[model samples]
Each structure stands twice: as structure tokens, then as C-alpha cells.
Target: MRLRLLLCVLCWLGTTPALAAENSRVLTTIKPLQQIAAAVMKDIDTPALLMEPGASPHSYALRPSDRRALAEAERIYWIGPELELFLQDLLERQDSAVDLLHLPQMAVRKQQQAHNFQKDEHASHAHGHEHDHGSLDAHIWLSPDNAKVVARYMAEDLASVYPQHVDQLQANLAVFERSLTALDDRLQVRLSPLRDKPYFVFHDGYGYFEDHYGVKPQGIFSLSHEVQPGARHVNQLRQQLQAAGPSCVFTEPQFTPRLVNSLTQGLPVTVGVLDPLGSAIDVGPKGYEHMLEDMSGALADCLEAL
Candidate 1:
């Protein structure tokens, strides 16, 4: 009887760490997804980011470390094939991974094609699963409403994996929703004044944000960050800029091509930087909010009257 009791105690001790490890291994594909996951898993487990800052998801290849991270993770959250193309095959092998874009609750927007730029000549050579780029804009996190849906979905998945922390996850989701609501109200007021102001973005990625906030973008220079606009397209953009006299032209930190300088060489438009991936922002519970606030500030700074 004594021997049997001792073996039971030893087995219980050995299983504790394994159980803890199972519950704590949450991973996200990008920083923004990490930010949302971190917010939902606050005080539970800090979700790890797969793609480091400054890396473009459109063309990123998976490192060995990323493969290991995916294997070890008990729960994985990502924007799906349209965004993180590198993860498609690895995720197919893992049935547990959650594709946030496929969630019925998520309000997905269609990808906006570049107004005058030609179709990608290398579209066939593009890596990852064949994504319908025209069908959906996988940058769903840009919209606060979509972020809320993602947070709720994350909370549900986290609760299932770590049942002991369900209460905390639900609580975190509530707080995130409230914070998002407050931020939306603030941004609406701040960005409303710039509704009529015209601007140009380097790429069509900002459609969701622009549509959500009613900000005006005269046009986009490229359909995808990986693709460059042709010389004729650039000349057309120059002519449009000359005629419309846009308040600003926004370029992303990930791609500050020389073309932007060429477009505004003698124009009155102010240049501003926008970071859609939250690449520079530190990942935490409030990272998503900070990203939206920063974007709003960038827009207002350039769009407001001098």
C-alpha cells in the first residue's frame, strides 16, 4: 500500500509541468495578431510572435525556428493564407490552429485593386498558396470592429484550451471591447475633420481603415507592397497629384520607395509615414490601441491645415 501511494504522488508531480506547458503555448503569426492575442490572454500567458518586426508578411519565408515554434504551440492564431502565406502548409498539418479570417463573425473586406497600376506580371511566381487577392483584404485587424470579433474568437479558443483560465480570458475580452469602443469614439472625432481632405497611400492596404473612418484617399500607387508601379502609372499619379493637390501622400515604413519622392518633387503635398503592421510598437495588451492611435495621428498630422 505504501509503495503504491508513493508511485501515485510521483506520477502527479511529473504531469504538472506537462499540463502547464500545454496550457501556456499560445502563438500568433504577426505582431498585430500577437497584440490581440496578448490582450485576450493577459494574466494567463503572453502569446509569442512568429514574424519579427519590419518583416513583410507578403513575402516572408519561414525560418527553422518558426517551424519549431509552430510545432510546440498548443494554440496558434493567424490572419490566414491571404496574409501569412508562409504558414499555410504548416498549419494544414496542425488541425488545432485557428484561422481568424475564416471566423464567421469577422467582418472581412475585399482587397482594393490599384486604380491605374497594371496586373502583377509575376503574380504566377508569387509564393504561398494561391490566394484570391481580389476577393478579400486580409488586413482585417485595421478595423476596430473586426479586432473585436478577433478578440472574442481568441477568448473562446483560449478558454477551451485552458479551461482553468476561462474566467480571466472572458474578463480580458470584456476589457478589450470596452477599450476598443473608447478608442473608436476618440478616433471618430479626431479623424472626422479630415474626411474631406484628399490623400494618397503607397498601397491599397489601407482601404479598411479608410472606409471605416471615412478618410479620403485619392488613389493608391501599388496593389501589393511587393509589386512596384510602372513608369506610366507613376506619371499618371503625378498628373493626378498636380490636379487634385492632395493634402498628403502616405508611405509605409516597410516600403519607402524613391518613387514617393519623385511623385512629390515639386508638389505641395506633405509626406507622412503609416505602419499597418504595428512593427515599431511594443507588443502588449494595449498595442492594438496604440497602433490605431498612431495611425490616426499620422493621418491628422498631414491632413490638417498648416
Candidate 2:
């Protein structure tokens, strides 16, 4: 009886959460990052999403629970100073024990590479708002290549913390790569039917998607929401619409589309709303896949209608 009891205790100890929970606590700043972490942590528990769905990372205020989570987190992932400026101070204040990964920093060096190319191209880009010196577009995960980089980093982070599960983590990453590849293939097939269709966006936020998919924007209403276009610029955009032959004018959900309506007055131009922030979608537990799918479907719909 004593021997049996001892063996039962050992088995229970082996299966307890204290033994398995070390690698389970992951915290990510945004929904997209959380999705990448989810892909990498397939068999593991879902990560705590710091910024909830429909919340803007730019203006997210931390709650008391969020503060505690950040302080106690074993691993945290974020895009860095470009997008989540608010989290900079909190992140900086953390002690040395915490493991944190900055996705934009680890993934791409676009700030250095794209500057020279864009300098001459955007020489007169003075709408009002100042650009960051390094000016890294924190929106790296928007690109499939960058998403792969993030997945790699996530795998590394998981492996580092839980070397015992390294094989499992790598296998999960392989599955993630396969899934992302399949998603890209599906997007390519859907987009093949509308490659030549041109559109205008309220902002130049679609550069990553456009570059990846070879889609072109005929005109941009603005670079950032901070600045409104001048009267001359608006009129020029209006004239471009008139001459471009019924291109889709994409507006943001948060922004008013009245300007677009006035610009293409009496014309049959298609005006569609594109939410780069995944604003319109639910983006809850299973909503991440739906969000990306909807974006692609929305673009396809707009292009087909054109």
C-alpha cells in the first residue's frame, strides 16, 4: 500500500501544472502578434492579448491587470516604439529577468533600407506631421515575409524558455509556415482575377500589401490621419479620379468618406472602406483568421466590382 501510494504521488507530481506551466505564460501586445504567437504555441495555452480587439494600440490605456501581467510575464512580444509608443516607458521600466522580443526590430531593417528610396520619391512629403528618425514602419507583420520573421522569433523565444519542448515548438512552426503559405496561395489565386485594377486609399498604409501583391494605388488622400490634405491636393486627387476611369476610392472606417464623394461627384467611382487596423472584424479567439480573410475578400470584391 505504501509503495502504491508513493507511485501515485509521483505520477501526480509529474502531471501537475507547476511542472508544465513554465512555458505557458506568453503575453503579446496586439491581436496580430497574438495570432503569430498562437500559431507557434499551438499545443500550448493561448497567450494573453494585451490590447484587446477593436482597441487602438496607439491609444490603449493599460489597466491594473495589464500592469501586473507585464510585470510578471515570462515572455512578452511587441512591435516596438513605432506603433506602441505608449508601452515604451512600461517596457523600459521592467527588470532584467523578463524576456521580451520586439518584432519590428528583430524582423526587418526597413527603416534603414527604405529611407534612401523614399527620400527622393517623397521629397515634398510635407503635410505637417514629422516622421521618426529611424521611422521604422511598425506594421511589419502586415507583410507575409515579415510575418515569417516574427514566427521564427516566436519559435526562438519559445525554444529558449522551454528547451525540452523545442522539438514540439519547431514542429508547430513548420505547421505555421505551411498554413501561412497556403493562405498566401489562396490570396494570390483570388487576386489573380483583379491584378490590373487600380484603387485610391485614404492613406499610404497599404504599401506592404501592395508591394507583396503587385497592386497599385492611383492616389493617396493622406499619409497619416494627423494631416488633412490641402485644397490643391484634394482638387488634384479629384482630377486624378476623373482621368483614372472609375477606380475604387478606399476610405478608412474611422475617417469620413465625404471628401471622396465630393471628389468623384457625378461619377460612377466605387467607394469602399478598408480597415487596415482590423477595426470592423471581431478578431476574438477565432476572429484572427476571419479578419485577414475578410480583408482579402473585401479587396477582391471591390476589384471585381470595378
Candidate 3:
């Protein structure tokens, strides 16, 4: 009788874990997507994020460990080939067991060229150096509207995989949407003064942000860290910056400031940095909201300084 009880206990223990594992396991590409996945899987133990702090997904090469994690995850979400160029083949080859959530699926907007950041004399100035890069701005999470779409998708995915959590996922989605709506209202009011304002960015990742807020960026100095502006593009941008006389020209942390310095030379413009991602500021758990707020405040401060 005692032996029978022990066997039954072991069987129950094994079955419980197997059942739990069958419920859900998610892995996302970036920190922003991690936060979204976290909200959707609020009831889960923990989800995984592929990109780490200070890691550049633009040119990140996958390690063997990364491949193992991707193969193990139940679902994985990312902005698509624009950023994860290296993962394209891996994703395609992924077994049917792993679910892939490509954000730019049926709702993909027309793609745009990345911002330019190369100086006119980039090639000549390289001290025996050559750099090759092909990446468009993959910072789609910067826009609140896009965030809403992703949040909704994440919630649906969570519910679909774990039907028992359908109610919980629905509630989470409503809460996420409400938070986004509140953030959007605050941003609209805060950025109202600068709605029609002409500005410039070190990179062109702000197109969605600018479009949503009715602001027009004067020009893109660089697309990603790897892209450099050619001589002709630099001259054209220089002329535009001079003509527009934008209040501020922004740069990011990951890239060089060489292009920024060259473009703003002899031009009356204050240089500021806008982090489309929440690296510079402590945006809190709601990092997406924090990113938008920091950007608005930074732009406002720059404009007021002028």
C-alpha cells in the first residue's frame, strides 16, 4: 500500500509539470517586446527576451546558446527582417512546434529607407577601415499606435496558446490598451505645441512617431550605426538643414556623432539626443510610456532652449 502511494505521488508530480509546460512559454526579440510579453503573460513564471541591454540587434550574430533558446521557445515575437536580418533563415527553418509572431504581417506599412549618418568623407577618413551594413530602422515600438497593435497581438497569442488564460489575457489587453490610451492623451497634449514643428533626427526611426504626432522631421542623418551618408546625400541634407533651420538635431547613443557635427556645422541648431528605445531614461516597468514621455520632454526642452 505504501509503495502504491509513492508511485501515485511521483506520477502526479510529473504530470503537473508537463501540464504546466504545455500552457505557455514566450521569447521576444527586444526589451520593448519583453515588456509586452510580460504584460500578456502576467500569470506565467517568466518569459525570455533575446536582445540584452547594450546589445545591438542590428548586427548581432547569434551564438549557439541563442539558437538553442529559439528552438525551445513556444512562441517568439520580433519586428521582422528589418532588424533581425541574421535570424531570417533560422525563423524560416523553425519547426512547426515553435510559433513565430512577425509583427509586420498583414498590417505592414510601406517600408522606408533608413536614416543616413555617414560623413561626406567617410571612406577617405577611415584609417584602413571598411564597414558594410544593410538595416532599416526597426524601432517600430516607438509609436503608441504600433504599441497598441503589438499589445493586442500579444494578448491574442497568449490566449490562443493557453486557452485557460483567455479571460486573464483579455483583461490584460484591456488594461494595456487603457494605459496606452492615457499615454497617448498625455503625449498629444504635451507635444501639441510642437505638432507642426520641423525637427531633424540622427536616424529616421522617428517617422512613425512624427506621423502620429503631426511633426515633420527635416532629414535623417543616418539609418542605423552601420549606415553612413554618401557625399551627395550629405550635401542635400546640409542644404535642407540650412533652409529649415530646425530647432534641434538629435543623435542616439549607439552611433558616432561625426555626422551630426558635420551637418550642424555653421548651422544655427541645438543638438539633442532622442532615444527611440528606453536606454537613456528610466522609463519604469511601463518603459514604452517612458520612452514617449522622455522624447516629448527632450524635444520640448530643446525647443524652449531655442
The candidate scoring highest on lDDT is: 1
Output the TM-score of candidate 2. 0.73
lDDT of 2: 0.65
Q: Which digits, one per residue and each the tens of the lDDT, describe model 2 over residues 1-306?
A: 999999999988754432232333777787777777777877755666676666776667876657767776778787776667788888867542222235344444343222322222222332223345465555666677677777787788777667788987888888877777788889888887687898876544566776777776766654334344455655666676778786788776655455455566776588887766675555343344555667777788988987
**Candidates sorted on lDDT, descending:** 1, 2, 3
Worst 10 residues of 2 by lDDT: 112-121
TM-score of each: 0.85, 0.73, 0.74
Candidate 1 backbone clash number: 0
Error of 3 at 295 (Å): 2.5
* Top candidate, metric TM-score: 1
**Model 1 root-mean-square deviation:** 9.2
Candidate 2, residue 86: the lDDT equals 80
Can you tell me which runs of candidate 1 are displaced by over 4 Å?
1-24, 116-133, 223-230
Could you tally the backbone clashes for each prediction? Answer: 0, 0, 8
